[model samples]
Every structure is written in structure tokens, then in C-alpha cells.
Target chain A: MAVTTLEPTTGTVPTRRGPDSPRRRKVRRQAWLFMGLAHVLTLKQYLVGAFFAVLELLFLISLPQIVTNLANLVTLGEPALDVPVKERPNSLFMLVDGVITIALILLFVAVYYVSVRSALTQERAWPPDEPTPPRRRLRDTITGAAFPVLGLAPTVVLLIFFVVVPLVFSTLVAFTNYSAPDHIPPAKTIDWVGLDTFVYMFGGSATWTAALARVFTWTIVWALAATVTCYFGGMLIAVLLTENRFRVTPLLRAIFILPYAIPSVVSLLYWQNALNGAFGTVNRTLLALGLIDSPIPWLSDAWLAKFTVVTINLWAGFPYFMLLIIGTMTSISKDVLEAAEVDGASKVSRFRHIVLPLVMYQTAPLMILSFAHNLNNFGAIFFLTGGDPAVADTTTTGAGGTDIMVSWIYKLTITLLKYNQASVLAVMIFVVLAPFAIFQFQRTKSYREGEL
Target chain B: MSDVVVRRINTAAVAIIFTVVAIAVLWPVVHLVSAAFTPGRSMANMPVIPFSNGFTTEHFEYLFTQTDYLRWFGNTLIVATATCLGTLLFASLGAYVFSRFRFTFKRPLLMGMLILQVFPSFVGMVAIYVLLYRIGGLDTLWGLVLFYIAGNMPFMIWLVKSYVDGIPRSLDEAARIDGASNLRTYAQIIVPVARPILTFLAVTSFTAPWMDFILPKLILRSPERQTLALGLFSFVTDKNNFFTTFAAGGLLVAVPFVIFFIATQKSLIASLAGGAVKE
Candidate 1:
């Protein structure tokens, strides 16, 4: 404990006699390391914290230098890895990955600096102020951080490694020319073609530009159609089942929730089979009913496929709204309804005027959320249509009739192996959907108030 | 007399509408069960009543004996259990910190978490893949759990923190006065009171991976390491597919979930509403 707080006792040998000692003078100088902050811990805590900080610094140092050199390669065109390839590997991914790793390391250093700086603050008062010493004990001055650091260690580690690093890496990949053919690593070196991919995606290639316009339009349409149909359909079913004076309404509600209760993957596959172009259960039933002279192309023909996926999406999704509506309805105040009744409102009018708005009011945030959710509803699109009923114009671009932004990204990445394009598309998704998400969450007012 | 007649007609109309809607909603579930029990029933010749033919358990037998389903089931169980346990532990601890402690970075940290959750995590799939591959965790269940538990931490923290805040600090004070440390106080006093929320978290965490397809499909490579969703999906993906066997596998996957849903239906709906549509 270097900055030990010496009690200046008047009767005790003038503790000032030792004030001129070198160690004492050094302590006095270091005591004001934290000028304004209160020293909140004891000397034991300071040692424990210092020990942990050193351990953390060592851990960070071990992993960062290798990535830093790789990042340097990105900023300057050169190879950093040990492997001597016959052909040099692309450095774009290396660059992105390296920058992410270094940034994470730098972030840790900042945190450590803050921790130590705060720990070194001199105590405003300690030991009831026995004629306060010029310097404090090293052990006691290192206060306030030990227990909190120990508690927060696991969560912070996870955030840094799993969340922060990956986000940065993904963001960096968006800036390079990472698409197919020439940019792949281990075969050919990737050079930074800053904003070229963005240019092509936005306004360069006629095919690319046309595809984005078309797919983006369809994405908006699908989100709106899917969300509205499900919401209204759910509201109708919930209203009927709950309001109707039927003994079996409870049983019917349970049965209706089956679609929601089943695994979405299974339900989606089942719908796909039921809508298959050639021998679907839906076609067989239609033929049996003579509703059509010939089987309709439910999952083929670009237009029909759009309708089919949306309808099937509604089929899989309505139960969620139904469940939500029912929960809200059950909790609705009967007094309001009775008051409306006294105002001469009939049943239908009561539903139209009183009940609908209340449910909508309560569920509006969720409805907007579902719209945003539908924007990236990969399961419904992927399992049901696989983004099929391909459009001839955008086939090379990989945007199909049923493709939402998310499934389109999946196609670009996995099937086409154009990760740079996929990362760009992912960023596009965030750009488009994140604001709406934040807006809807804000509209809820609960999150804003620190309610949860 | 006229009012009575109108009321009767209204009830009848509602009954008819509800019954039709229920039947339509139940069609897929009914078909799934029917297909599972009928041996080799393809989509081409599926009867209106899928179970019109005699029932057979051959599809299930094929699943167990001819496929690595038991292994998939084991893998899913391990992953789900680990995820639930890991999420419960991490979320509770993080929530406690936010609820009880005041620090400079608390608000910003919470806000960052909320913003982070707004973007889907799959956007970072390639990045995560590279990280995991370098760290030797790419193809393992533990890797999947680490991803999921970390992914789920923010929302769960927000949820459990709100619940913790509702718990009075006086209880903690009382425990501290009784010679208890913070850890002891949290363990004995607060944790017991937060059981409902914790159980809600466990159920959701367990069920999420059970229904999920994207991450499992992206990460796992070998057939032996497949989850139920991946294994069942393989049935229809290949040439000369077995739709019946796929249905059988799907049915098996859904059975436990359906039972759990029915048992906890009320709590599930309440939690869903509270978590999603907060007021």
C-alpha cells in the first residue's frame, strides 16, 4: 500500500517528521491521481483490482497483435498471415476481420484506463479525518471497483467477443468489393473497391438497379399484405369466438392456436406441400370440389406464387394475433362496454366503435413490429417458396418473386457465395428496417419510461 | 320478441364463422398427424382425410432405425438444456446488476442493448462463422449455445431487470442487516421471489431453439450432428423423398411442444403480450 493515509497525531512524534521521507513524498504526489472523485474502496480491493487488470491486459495483448498486422495489410496492400500461398489470398476479409479485432482491443484499453484512473482518486475523508495525511495508502485508495468488476466480467467478455467484434467486422465487409469471381480469398487477392458495389447495387447496372427496385417494391407489398391480413383475420376470429354465446368457443380457440403451437418449420413445409405446383393437396381438393376445372398453379406463376406465399404466411401467422387479441379482450374492461350499451350501441356498433379501437390501440406497436418482422421473415419465404417462381429479369441477381430482403440475402450468400454482396444487402436491411423498428418501439412508450 | 330473435341469429352466425375458421386453422396440424401415421403417403395422392387409409408406424420405425434421429434428439436436448441454464444464469446476474447498482455507464449500456436487438443477429453470420472456425467451436453444440445465449441475453436482461426492480430494495437491506453479503442476499431473498419470470425465461429459451432452423442449418455440417429441424427437413430436400417420414419426424418434434403449450398456455400468452406489446 504505497499511498497509505498516515494519521497526523499531534502527540505522536509529529508524524510530519516522516513526511520528508522519499516514500512519503511519492505517496503525496500519487494521492491526487483522482482529484475530484471519492475513493470508495480499501487497499485490499486496490491490489485485487490491479491484479485483475494486469491479467486482462495480458489476455488482450496475446490475441491482438496478430489481428493488428492483418489490419495493416488491409490499409496497405500486403500479406500478413504465415501461410505462403502459390497465389496470394484476398486481403479484404482479412482487413475487415483485423480492424474489428483491433477496435475491440482498443475499446478494452480505454475501459482499463478509466478503471485505474477512477481507482486512484484520493478519498475526501477516511478514518474520521485524524488531521489528514499528505498521502493515502495504495491499498485503500484502490476502492469501488473490485466487486463490480468481478460481477460484470462474464457479461462484458461475451459482449466484446460475440457481439461487438462481429458487428464491426460485418460493417467493414460492406465497404469492399467482395462479390463472386475475382474477390474470393485463398485463390485471388481482394482489393478495396470502395463504394463500387454500392454504386452498382444502387444505380449502375440496369439489371441490378431494376432488380432492387422490383424486389424492394414487392418487399413492401408483402410486409403490408401479410401484416394486415393476419391482424384483421386474427381480430375477427377472436371477436367472434369470445363474443359469441357458444359453449364450444373455448375449445375452438384452443384448436385455432394449433398453427401457432406447431413448429413453424414443420408448418411451413406442410404448406409448401399443400401448394406444390404439380400434385399439391390444395389442387387435389380444388379438383375434387369442382371449384376449378383444372388445378390452379398455387405455387407457380409469379403472381399466384406471391399470393400463395402471402396467404400461407397469413395462415401460419394469424394465430399469433388471435392469441394476442384474445388476451387483450379478456382483460378489456366490461364497464366501458356497459357504458356504451347505455348509450344505445348495438352489438355490431359496439364492436365497431368500442372494442376494435381498444385492441388496435393496445396492439398497434406489435402490429408495426410484425410488419418489420415480416420484412425479414426468412422462414415463411424460404420454407414455403424458397423464393421460387423465379423472375427472368432478376434470376442472375437472385431476387425471386417471393423473396423478401432477408431471404434474398440468404440466396446471395449461401447459393451464390457472394458474401460481399450479402453483407451489403444486410446493411441495406438494417438501413431500411432499423428506423421503423426504433420508431415502433418508441411508440410503445414503455421502453422510453424505463418501465422495462 | 324481435330483440330475442335477433340475438339468436347473431349467435348462430358467430358459431358458424368460428367453426369454419377453426377447421381451416386445424387442417395442417391434422394433415401432419395423418401423414405421419400413413406409410409413404406422398403429396400427390394425399386423400382429403389423410388418415382414411390404415395407420402404420413404419415411418417412425424408419426414422429411429434408418436415420440418426436419436442422435439429433440427444443433441437438441443438450443444446436446449444448456441454453436455458446459461440464459437463466447470465440474464439473472446482468439484470440484478442493472436493477440494484447505479453506475455511470448503466443507461447507455441498456440503450445499446435495445438498439443491438433491433437488427437481426443473422446479419453477422459470416463473421460469427469465421470467429468460431478460428476458435475451434464452429461445428459444435456448445458453439450454437454460446451464440444463442449471447443473442438472447439482452432481451432477457431487460425482462428480468424490470421484474427485479419491482422487488423492493428493502428486502435486500433486510438481508444485508442480517450479516448477508450481496451475493447471499441476492441468492436467498431476490431469486426466490423472481421464480415466475425465470421460469418464463427457461421455457422460452428451450422452445426457441426447438423451433429454429437458420442457425442450426448454417453451423452444423455433419448428418450425425443434425437437430430435429435439420434432420426432418432433409426428408423433403433430397430426390425420391419420404414425405411420410418427414411428417413423422415433425410430429415427434411438435408433441412435447404442443403438450407444453397446452399446459402453460395462459402464462405463455401473458408473457408474450407483456414482452411484445408493453403498456
Candidate 2:
């Protein structure tokens, strides 16, 4: 990270005389006069420039008074309107006063511009023939500083406005009692109730705690079940598809990707319908084949609901895993696989000993990410069941039997209009998921660098 | 001879396993599309002989006539296209700078982008809602696109920048020596070379705004502004004839991406894996 500086071709100093000399002073004065004229010309180039310039000047002059008035309104909770009519300024009157003040400020700016131009003309400092000083270097560096800042400004502003600010606000809401009727108008103010929501959410009733525990347990179960199932499922598919001797490998790969190619919402919705409790094709076919006496409530019962969501997730996610694993499998050097073959290693042994480990090592971060994704999986659970099979007698608002943290957050925000509570849940979810995200990010960064 | 024959048998057996697994993966989807035109209210009510009930386009027709399917499709296309274009422009410029420049605070800037990616998209849901409400973007397509880009920019920058980094620096130097300005160099030399990864990014980024339900549902409160994903949700939740039409709509949504994947599967697979490794 050493800074590389290029050498200047000539001595930094020009042959011009000192600024105190008559020649230098004349050049400096002329430069000032030219700059003043340039400023006037620039203003003339745009029709509204003069107007805006005056407006800008007025804004600058009256900014302090404006700030004071704003502070008064904010701190005093709106101006008292019941004061004596003769003594009191009404809010409308105050607004008018502000406008007049701004107008006077604009007039002042018009006058100041004339004076500043005359001053700059009298004391100009320019002309490149003069030797540049260390101060010029400092000026150059200061101006150059804006380059990187300008380059990064959009990203930084976006992050602050969209990411950082939201995160802080959400975290703040988590400490307050911000839910339900308390969230309604005027009475709807988000009251600061420190840890009350968390305590109520995690404690209070056994049912509340039990419901949370169930969701958390299922969240972990879904993440694990989905990740592991997809991982092995993908690995197996990749291995089969990539085998050199396998004819029609392209056709098989295409078939394998059908699930991945389809949008998750479409597939998930279709599957939800297909797995309907009574007349779903699966149930109908199963019963017709005499597999079971009763149609299983695939989405109504809690366990069945959880199982179905995972199964749907598996279908939706495994193709992605297969695609990724196949890609990683191809990148595995041929020599190593050939070496395994030369050693007379059986196909299973070669896969178990060589291929699986290599692919896992390469794809470990993605697997971690997939796990985190499943934990916060709102789409599958949402489109499929909308977190249905409502938990019995649960006091929580919209806590479905199958809701993950995300769907629950959705329930709070969109369904119940409990922004404060939703914000809290969102922050809590971030806190839980942040570490895994960090790990994935770091691993990916290093992996990228390694590839480079 | 004996060993070779055994290995051949094993390979055939492996291929057979794959064929079966492929069928298993495809069966549900195939059944779904078939059931979409099953010509009955429920599966139980349908004739046992699949197409014997007579093939029908009723589900698709129902989707068009009953729901706001066309509106949803148009909204999704507009948002997805705008998002793709916006993402490509901003992410490419940002990634180019990150990849090429040696500047102060570069590490911190890169790190910030990475960290931003990790914050769940939903965390910003409240803040964005308020911000958009203030700015009058509520229930608007533009509001959805803005949030979509904001949610997606970090990952796209990281992905695209890494791909750009893999291109030889000499190519840039060569162009510069030929009197190409920085902008020209990027536009002429770098972008063309990086087309594969750019396609990957465009498709994936476009797919996000297209497939996303949560953001559109939260932002687009008006039924007319609903994207396909949100529009489909209406039918899925209808609890009646909507389910069959929902399947048809789902098929409609899936068709384009599936066709795209099939057409560009090779490049898509290559770039996806390349991006993962680069990541």
C-alpha cells in the first residue's frame, strides 16, 4: 500500500518574480480583475443564475434566525395559540415574518456581491508565471481530496440512508413497548418500554415462550434440513451428471435444473396447491393407491406444516446446490481424480475421499450462507402457507404455527401494522444472523483474493 | 478385459441412478403443469385418464380474465428492466473504480460494501417505508425499483468488481497506451471482455426484482402496481378457483427464466461458478 508518486519534469518553481515586486503585483491584480469578470459572465450565461445567487445569499444570511425559530417550535411543542391577540404572533404571522426576513436577506446578498467583486478585483492572486509555493501544493491536495470522496459519495449516502440508519432505528425500537393498540394514532406513539417487549416475548406466559421456542427450533431445523439435504442432494446430482462416461449428461443436467430455473414463488405456490389437505394431487393419488386411509393435513398440522415447508425448500434450493456443486466439481483438477482412479479406488470411495471434501471445502461459505437464508426464509413459508395452521390460543399477533422470524416480522409489519414491534423483531433477527453473515463475507472476500 | 467390463457396468449403473434422480427432480414440476390444465375443480374431480378429459387452455384464460395478471406482468417487466439497467450502470462504474484505482480508504470502502451486503434486506424495510412515504414513492413502481437497487447494489458491486479484477490489467494499459481515456478504456476494452459476467449479473439482478414478493408487497399497496410475485399472491390466497389459475400464473412467470436458463445454461453455469470462486 505504498503511495507511488511521479517526479515532476522541471523544477516546481517558475521564473516569475516575488509577489511583493511590481510585476507580480500587477499580474495578481489583473488576475483578480479577470476572475471577477468571469464570475459576472458565468452569472449572465444562465437566466436564473442571478436570481438563485441572490436567493442563496439570502438563505445564508438568515439561516441562524431560521434555525432559532425552528428550535423554538420543536422545543416548545408548537407555538401557544391562546396568547393575547395584541401581544402574540400567530403561526401564520410568524411564517410571513420569516418570508420578509428572507427577502431582506436576498437584498443584502445582491449588495454584498458588488462589494466582494470590487474587493477581489483590487486584490487578485493568480498568474502561473509566478513560482508555486508549498501552500499551492496544500491547495492542490485539498482539491484532489474531493475525487475519492465524490467517487464513493453515492455508495456512502445510500448505505447511511438505507442500511445504517435503518439498522440503528430498528435497534432503538426493540427496547420500547411498540405494538398493537399502543401503536394507534396519538395514542399510537411508540412509548419507551425498556426490555419490556423482549421480556414479554421471551417470558410472561408459557404459551408465548413455547411458541417462540417452537419457531426457533423449527428455524434451526429448517436451516439444517434444507442445507444438508440440498448439499448432499446437489453433490450426488453433480457427480452423476459430470461423470465422463454418462451419456445424455446434458439432458440430465437440464432436467435437474428445472426446479432451479423456475421462480421459487411459482414453484412454491404450485407445490402448496399440489399438497392441499384433501384434494391435492399427492393426497388423491396416495389415497387412490391405498397408501393411507386419511388425507394428511399437509399444511394444517404444525409438524406437517414444518415438514412440508422444508420439503418445498429442498425442492426449490437443491438445484442451486447442484448447479454450484457441479461447477465446483468441474474446477477440481483432473489429475487428482485420475490419481484416485489409478489407485483402484472405488467410485464411492473416490467421491467420499476426494470429490466431496474438495467441493465442500470450496463451497463451505455458500453452505453457511444458504443456512442463514433458510433461517430467515420468508418467501417459501409465506407463499406456501402464509405461516398457517395458526397456533392455538397464542396471544401474539399473527404468529402462525409455521412462521419463521421473517414471516413473523412480515406479520407484524404488514398484517398488524405494528411497526415498532416489527422493527424490534427485525433487529433481533439481524443480531442473531450477523455473525454467520460476517463469516460468509470474510470467507468470500478471501476466496476472491485467492482467485485473483 | 474383466476389470474394464466391470467399470463399464458401474458407469452405466451411475448413469441410471442419475437418470432416475433427474426424473424425481422433474416429476413434481411436470405434474404441476399438467395439473394446471387438468380440466376440473380439484384433482379428485378430474378424470383419471390425464389428458383424456381433453386438453384445455382454461386455466391460462381464467388467469388473464379474472386476475390482474397482465398488469402484474407489465409492472414486473418495467421494474425488472429498470433495475437491471440501473444496477449495471452504477455497479459497473463503482466496480471499475474499485478494481482499477489505488486510492486512500480503498480497503475501508470495499469493506463497507461487503458489510452492507450482510445486513438483511428486511432491516431497512421500515426506514425505506418512511423515507419513501415522505418522498411520495409509496405504492409507486419507482419506489420499488429504488429499494430494489439499494438492496441489490452492494452484492452486484462485489460480484462484478471481482470479475473485473480477474481481467488482465495489461488490457487496460494497452488501451491507455493507444490514447484511450479511462472512460473509453472501460467502455471499449473492459466491458466487452467482461460481457459473460455482466450477463450473469444482469440476469440474476433482474430475476430478484422479478421474483421478489416481500418488497413489492410492502411497497406497492395498490393492486394495479403489483408485480407478478405480489399479483400471484392474490390468487394463491384466494382459496377457490384461484389455485389453478395461480399455477398457470406461476408457469407463466417461470417460463421466461427457464427458457433463458436453457438457452444460456453453459455461460450461466460458467459465470455463476466463476463468480462464486471469485467471491
**Candidate 2's residue-wise lDDT over A326-407, tens digit each?**
8888888999989989999987899889988888787887888888877877887888898888878444666888888788
- lDDT (C-alpha) at residue B111 in model 2: 73
Return the top candidate by TM-score.
Answer: 1
Q: Tell me how far the alpha carbon of residue B112 in candidate 2 is from the true structure, in angstroms, after superposition.
A: 1.9
Go through the candidates in order and give the clash count of each. Answer: 11, 1
List runs of model 1 lying over 4 Å from the truth.
A1-46, A56-67, A70-73, A76-93, A117-147, A339-350, A440-452, B238-240, B276-279
Report clash pairs, candidate 2. Answer: A184-A188
- What would the TM-score be for candidate 1 when compared with the true structure? 0.88
| Interface DockQ of candidate 2 | 0.39
Looking at candidate 2 chain A, the ten consecutive residues that score lowest on lDDT are A2-11
lDDT minimum window of 10 residues, candidate 1 chain B: B100-109
